[model samples]
Target: MTAYIALAVVVVIVIWAVAIYNRLRTYKNQVENAFAQIDVQLKRRHDLIPNLVEVARGYMQHEAQTLEAVIRARSTAVSAADEARQSPGQAQAMGALMVAEQALVGQMGRLMALAEAYPTLKADARMQQLSEEITSTENRIGFARQAYNDQVLDFNNEASQFPDLIVARLAGFAHMEMLQSTQNEQERAIPQVKF
Candidate 1:
């Protein structure tokens, strides 16, 4: 009787541990999958940038500095993204990548504003298509990033809770940091013109 009772308790503990481990694994994979979605959108955005720059170069001869800034920002962002890809779970790399992405967005905004001053550029069919594509890519990236952060939050909550935290530590499951945007709400808001 005693042996049977001990065996049942051990089996229950083993099953419980396995369940916790599997849950942690699912959350980790979810975070990675979310990041992959973001990566695809970012790649599409990066590819469109050079084409936009090339199209703008012809019409915006006097705006060399703005064009150069956009190019530099794009290059930095691409490099940071590559680093983040190599270590998707590393907090520092993810944080740096987010900062680079925001900087790239800001530079792209500047380039677009400059484009508004060029009537011929705005009228170009190719430029319009590329601009539309970039805007679509940006929206997808935003959605993907939100999903990634949500997954990170879920994983973090699991890892921080008492019994699960014990299991997480035993299973070597480190808490994941959410991929945060460098932009604030005010920065993202459009300025209203009363005039």
Candidate 2:
């Protein structure tokens, strides 16, 4: 009878371990999936930058500093993504990437506003195409960022919960930061710009 009880206890422990293992794996997958969404958006932005620079060059020849900033920022942003190929575990590494990403976003915003300064560029066919691409890509980025944050939130909750947290700690569950958004999420509810 005692032998049977020991066997039953061992079986129960094994089953419990497996259940916890699977739950943690599911949460980790969610985080990876979220980052993948972010990757697609970032890649789109990277691909669009060259076209944008080419389109704006003719009309904005006099605006060399602005053009240079856009190129420099894009380069840095792309490099940063490469650096963060994995979800960053170190705080400083993450911070550096965030700074680069924000710089890119700011530079892109400035690029769009450049349309106001260069009337000729605004009217050019290539510039117009670039503008359309920027607008579409920006909308997609916003969507993907939102999705990533949502996933992060779900993962975070699981990592912090009662029973789940127990498993989470054992499974190497460290908190992942949500996309550090500038605007309040509620304000980005539309996620699109008309211009």
Candidate 3:
């Protein structure tokens, strides 16, 4: 009787561990899939930028510095994105990507604002089309980013939970960093209106 009781206990423990391991694996996969969605949208944005710059170059010839800044920012963003793709959940890689992307956004904003000063550039059909495409891609990226953050939150919660934390540590599942908004407090703050 004592032998039978010991065998049953061992079997139960094995099954419990296996269950926890499977759950953690599933969450990790979901987080990766979420990041992949974001990557797709980012690629679209990156591809559109060069075309936009080319179209704007004709009318904004004197704005060489602005155009070059945009291109350089794009290159940095692409490299950062590649690093993040290799290790989606790693803190350092994600932080680098966010910083790179923020710089790209700032550069792009400057390009567009300069374009606004050039009526001919704004009126060009190619520039308008490229701008629209970039705007659409930006919206898609926002949605994908939100989804990625949600998945990260779910995975972090599961990995850090009581019983699961033990399995997570044993299985070497580290906590993931979520992609936060690149905006600073000033950007997020509401503006005051005067009548």
Candidate 4:
């Protein structure tokens, strides 16, 4: 009777451990999938930057500084993103990438403000189309970032919880930081440009 009870206890413990391991694995994969969504949107935004810069070059001749800032920011953002891709689970790399991304967005906003001064540039069909596309891509990136953050939060919570924390350690599940936008309230607000 004693031997039978011991065997049953061992089987139950093995099943529980397997279940927890599978749960952690699933959560980790979800985090990766969510990050992939952000990657796709960021790639779209990066591709649009050069076209926008090229279109503005002709009209914003005097505003070369602003255009250069945009290009420089884009380069930094791309490099940071590549680093994050190589180490997605590392909070340091991911944080740096998000900070770079926000810097790029700020430069883009500055370029937009400069473009506003050039009525001709704003009126040009190509510039207008590019602006619209870039705006759409930004929205997509925001949504993707939000989804990724949600996954990170869920995973973090799971990893921090009592029983799961033990499982997480044994399974090599590390804590992840949410991909955050460093935009201030003013930066987040829409600029009201008068014609």
Candidate 5:
């Protein structure tokens, strides 16, 4: 009777171990997929920048410095994008992308502010088309980032939970990074122009 009881205990332990391990595997995969989606959107955004720069260059002939800054920001973003694609697990890569993104936001703000000086630039057909496409891409990036963060939360929760965390730890499950919520991403009321 004692032998039978020991065998039953071993069987139950094996089943529990396998179940938790499988769940951890699934959670890790989910996090990767989520990151991949964000990566794809960011790449699309990067591809659109050169076209935008080209269009903006024609009108901002005297603003060579501003154009160079935009180019540098775009280059940083592309580098970050490549790193993210090659190694999704590296948090530093994500940080680089955030830096790149913040730089981009600043450059974009500068360009738009400069646009105020050149109304004809905004009126150009190529510039208008690029602006519309970039705006759409920006919307997609925002949505994708939100979705990636949401999935990261879910995966991290599962990875940290009681039995799962044990399995996660054994299987090398690491915590995923949260999306950066910088001041640039926040909204402020535009100052009123009571002319």
Candidate 6:
């Protein structure tokens, strides 16, 4: 009777551990899939940027500095994105990517503002089309980032739970960093409207 009871207890423990391990594995895979979706959108956004610059270059001959800044920012962002793709959940890589992307966005905004100053560039058909594409791509990237962060939250919750934490640690499942807003404090500040 003692031996039978001990065997049943061992079997139950094994089954419980296996279930936790499988759940953690599923969560990890979902996080990776979510990151992949973000990667695809980022790639699309990056690809459109050079064409945007080229179209603006013809009319904005005086804004060489702004155009160069955009190109440099884009290059940095591309490299950071490649690093993040290799290790999506890594804190350092994600941090670098966020910084680079923020710089790129700021530069792009400056370029667009300069474009608005030159009516000829603003009215060009190709310029208008590329701007529309970039805006669309930006929206897609936002959706993808939200989905990635949601998956990261779910994975972190599961992995950090008491009993599951044991399995997560044993199986080498680490917590993932969520993609946060790239906006700086100044950008996030609400504008004061004066009458």
Candidate lDDT values, in order:
0.89, 0.76, 0.93, 0.88, 0.79, 0.92
In the range 1-195, model 4's lDDT, one tens digit per residue, is 999999999999889878888888888888888888888888889999999999999998888898999999999999988888876757999988988998999999889988898999999999999999988988898898888889888888988898879988988888998887757678679999999
Candidate 6 — worst ten consecutive residues by lDDT sum?
Answer: 179-188
Better lDDT candidate (2, 4): 4
Top-down TM-score ranking? 3, 6, 4, 1, 5, 2
**Pick by TM-score: 3 or 5, better one:** 3
**Candidate 1 TM-score, true structure as reference:** 0.89
Q: What is the RMSD of candidate 6?
A: 1.6
> Candidate 6's residue-wise lDDT over 1-195, tens digit each?
999999999999899999999998888888889999989988998999999999999999999999999999999999999999998888898999999999999999999999999999999999999999988988888899999999999999999999999999998888899888766788789999999
Q: Candidate 6: give the clashing pairs.
A: none
Q: Any runs in candidate 4 off by more than 4 Å, and if so which? A: 1-4, 189-195
Which has the greatest lDDT? Answer: 3
Clashes of 6: 0
TM-score for candidate 6: 0.93
Spell out the clash pairs found in candidate 2: none
For model 5 the TM-score comes to 0.87
Estimate the Cα RMSD of every predicted model relative to the unseen true structure.
Answer: 2.3, 4.2, 1.1, 3.2, 2.8, 1.6
lDDT of 2 by residue, 18-63 (tens): 7876876786687677677777878888888888887787777777
TM-score of each model, paired residue for residue: 0.89, 0.84, 0.96, 0.90, 0.87, 0.93
Which candidate number maximizes TM-score?
Answer: 3
